[model samples]
Target: MSLLAVSNLAKRYRRGGKPFAAVDDISFEIGPAETLALAGPSGSGKSTIAKLVLRLIEPDAGRIDFEGGDFLALSGAALRTRRARLQMVFQDPLAAFNPRATVARVLDDPLRIYNIASRAERPRRIAALLERVGLDTSLAARAIHEISGGQRQRVAIARAIATRPSLIVLDEAVSALDVSVRGQILELLLDLQRQERIAYLFISHDLGVIRAVAHRVVILDAGRIAESGDARAVIADPQSAVGKALVAATPKLVRTSQDAS
Candidate 1:
């Protein structure tokens, strides 16, 4: 069975009394340990798709089935418990974390709430998580303001993994960092996937980033799927006009050759 399957999913809103579909009737499936990227230009509803799967917003129609069970069927207490198995790492880490809280406190909350580790063992786990995201455990007690943008992003990734989720929505998670740091974080995420076999829905506008990390690519255009296939194949040969535009818009794959200087 697929890890996740979305069938005929749709979400909409009204603008000036006109109904607009932010996400149309879209369907896709992801398998275990797979990295599937949803790529598109702005206003294409890729992020809206992410929100639907994560249940940040309810879909107006269709179904989200995870492991053959209906996700939308669960709510309130049941939904809260199911959340531990599916987590999201957002686009901006600085915005994601509370400025007032120490990194340790933020990361520790998931551990405590999920009951993943006892209070006594949380220290060791926090240290391990920091190391996994390429940060020193000593930085755990530091405020979000004290770290580089990259380090702050790592903290968010660490928090997401500390729950040991089966699926992670990396919604433009690496786009905010410096190019060099972005590469490192992508590598770290890949390493973790290898170690834990975590499935990722990596949403990004950067084809370079998508090509580097994704196994399969799902291209969205105007709130609908224009293309979906192997990342290498899709990057090399885009079937749709929108897909071609996305590839052409990239800046000469500078992200890959930036290291040669």
Candidate 2:
């Protein structure tokens, strides 16, 4: 069964005293352990779709079925419980987390909030989370702002997995990092997906990055799907005007291990 099913989803907004669709009649499905990427140019509603999927913002139309339940119909405690299986990683971890908060505190929030670990057991769990993300456990004592950008992003990833989510919405999750760090982060994501059977709704503008990680790619233009297919196939020979434009703007697609450094 599909881990996530979004059907005919739509979100509208007022622009210049006129209503416009930020996400228009979009539908897609993601399977367990799969990576589905949403790629589009700026103002193309990629982030808006990510927000809608995470329920940060409600859609004006259509349905969200997650794990075979009506995700849009959930409420109160039911919604909270269901949220444990849905998580997000933002483009900027510094903004996503309290810069003053320690790494341990950040990781502990999900464990405590979800009751995933007892107070007495949380320290060990936090350590394991850090280790799993390829970080030194001693960094737990450090404040989030004191860490490097790559370290901070890893911590963001660790926090996202703390809930043991079935699907993660990553909104430009690796775009801000340098090439080497970005490659590492992408590798970590792939490894985690392989290990835990987690699925990703990866939102990014970089087709090169999308090609490296995504199994399927959906190219959005002005809040609507313009084209979609196997990640490699669509990227290699884009059929839509917007898709072709995006490819032209990007650097040559070199088949590498995410161009790791």
Candidate 3:
């Protein structure tokens, strides 16, 4: 069974006193240890779908099932409890964290909030989380402001996995980083999925990143599904106008492991 299943999800919003659909009748699923990419232009409903699945915003219609449970129907403590298994990494990693907080403190908050470890054991857990993200524990003493953009993103990723979530919603997680750092982050994500067997719903406008990481691809355009299939097949032979345009517009250079450093 799919780890997450979303069906007929819809959301509407008021703009200039007129109602418009931001996400309309969109549906998709993520399998165990799978990466599904939601790609589209700036205004397409990509992020809206992410928020809807995460329950950050309530959908106007449809159902969200995670591991056979009704995610949309959950509320209060139940919702909070379910969130422990669902985590997110945002587009801007630095913006996701408090500037004044040290790396240790940032990682500690989720552990404490989830009660993943005892007060005395959190320090060790923090160090381990940092290590898994390719960061050394010494950097734990540094504040978010003191770290490089790449390191800040690493901390963001570390925090997401702290609770050992079943799935992660990475909303343009590597977009802000330059080409090199972006490559490393993608590799790190792939490695983490192998190690932890966690599923990912990767949201991005960059086709290159999606091609590199996603097993399946779902192209969204104007608040709807434009095309979806195996990542390689969709990229090679785009069926939709938006998909064709995206593939044509994408630069030919495929990022490599050497570019990571």
What does candidate 2's lDDT look like per residue over 8-92, in tens digits?
Answer: 9999999999999998999999999999999999989999999898999999999999999999999999999999999999999
Candidate ranking (TM-score, best to worst) = 2, 3, 1
lDDT of 2: 0.96
Worst 10 residues of 2 by lDDT: 252-261
TM-score of 1: 0.95
Best by lDDT: 2
Better of 1 and 2 by lDDT: 2
Return whichever of 2 and 3 wins on lDDT.
2
Maximum-TM-score candidate: 2
Off by over 4 Å in 3: 253-261
User: Candidate 2, TM-score vs. the true structure?
Assistant: 0.96
Per-model lDDT: 0.91, 0.96, 0.93
lDDT tens readout by residue for model 3, 1-261 = 999999999999999999999999998989999999999998799999999999989999999999889998899998888999999999887788889999999999999988899999999999999999999999999999999999999999999999999999999999999889998999999999999999999999999889889999999998999999999899989999999999999977667655742
* lDDT, candidate 1, at 83: 86
Model 1: how far residue 206 lies from native, Å:
0.6
Give RMSD to native, each candidate. 2.2, 2.4, 2.6
* Tens-digit lDDT string for candidate 1 (102-178): 99999999999988999999999999999988899899889988888888888998999988888999999988889
Error of 2 at 51 (Å): 0.6
Evaluation by TM-score, superior candidate among 1 and 3: 3
